[model samples]
Target: MISALTAPAPRAGNRAPRPIYVTKGGDMLNPFTPTPTDPPSYLAKYTARDTAPGLARRDAVRTLLSWGLEQLADAAELVVSELVTNVLSHTSTRTINVTLIRTGETTARIVVMDTDRTEIVLPACPGDDEEAGRGLRLVASMAVQWGVERVVTGKLIWCDLQEDR
Candidate 1:
């Protein structure tokens, strides 16, 4: 069983971090190997019920902050809260899954996956008087990058953050 994960440093002259996984045995696991059944590398996965979206968001941010990535805690908190709540709002699934990953020494990725088949329309800028509709705005402002992907189960929204250092 894979008990832990770590992202390998980016190669020389490269800015993108290599998404690698480290097991308890200290061996590197390739997430995109020839094996089609291999799961994507992730540090943790939290499952939450539809009745408690806040709890899921809190727990995910807490887990991320605990992984020695305190520098991006605020960003993680905002992104996770927004995306998870969006999932709760969009889908009728009894439960939702939040996946946390360390993509690099100072970078982390948070993905919220739901079972809804509907396409997600990325949020656009909101007006000054708007009270809502700024979830994706917050995500865009803080995340180094953010995007949505269509998966077999449903759609997954993700955001990446990097330490200021």
Candidate 2:
């Protein structure tokens, strides 16, 4: 599981807040500020055999770091791992594709595409004692925006988050 406490925006005064940490093990990191004209960012695609959930997580973290979004690594890793894990656990597909696309200066979309075309059930809040069914909750909680998109071959689960400069 990943945990991030967003830094509250500063009050009426002109003080811009410190970098809102996308925290990892409670450590604060870089700030992401987006300007109107920044170009897109890209991270290399990673393909994983459907059975290898850990590989997906490891590579997701690596990709985020390689893309220079240290601020997003922790949350991105968890989100990618959960999405890939869901495919492995719930579908018969043999492979999965993970892509990180940055459409704006401080914004990125995490895409997890699998050959399974089945619709995904948005995760419902589980009780305190429930051990399962919290994966998407982690994603929805951390990401600013997230959704499922149907593709010609299969469905892609996507989420967008803020990234650092």
Name every residue pair that clashes in candidate 1. Answer: none
Position 132, candidate 1: lDDT: 82
lDDT of 2 by residue, 23-64 (tens): 233111211222122343333233345435566566656655
Q: What are the clashing pairs of model 2?
A: none
Off by over 4 Å in 1: 1-51
Residue-wise lDDT of candidate 1 within 49-165, one digit each (tens)?
443455555655565555677887777777877887777766765456676777787887788777778776777678899888888878888988889899998888888889992
TM-score of 2: 0.65
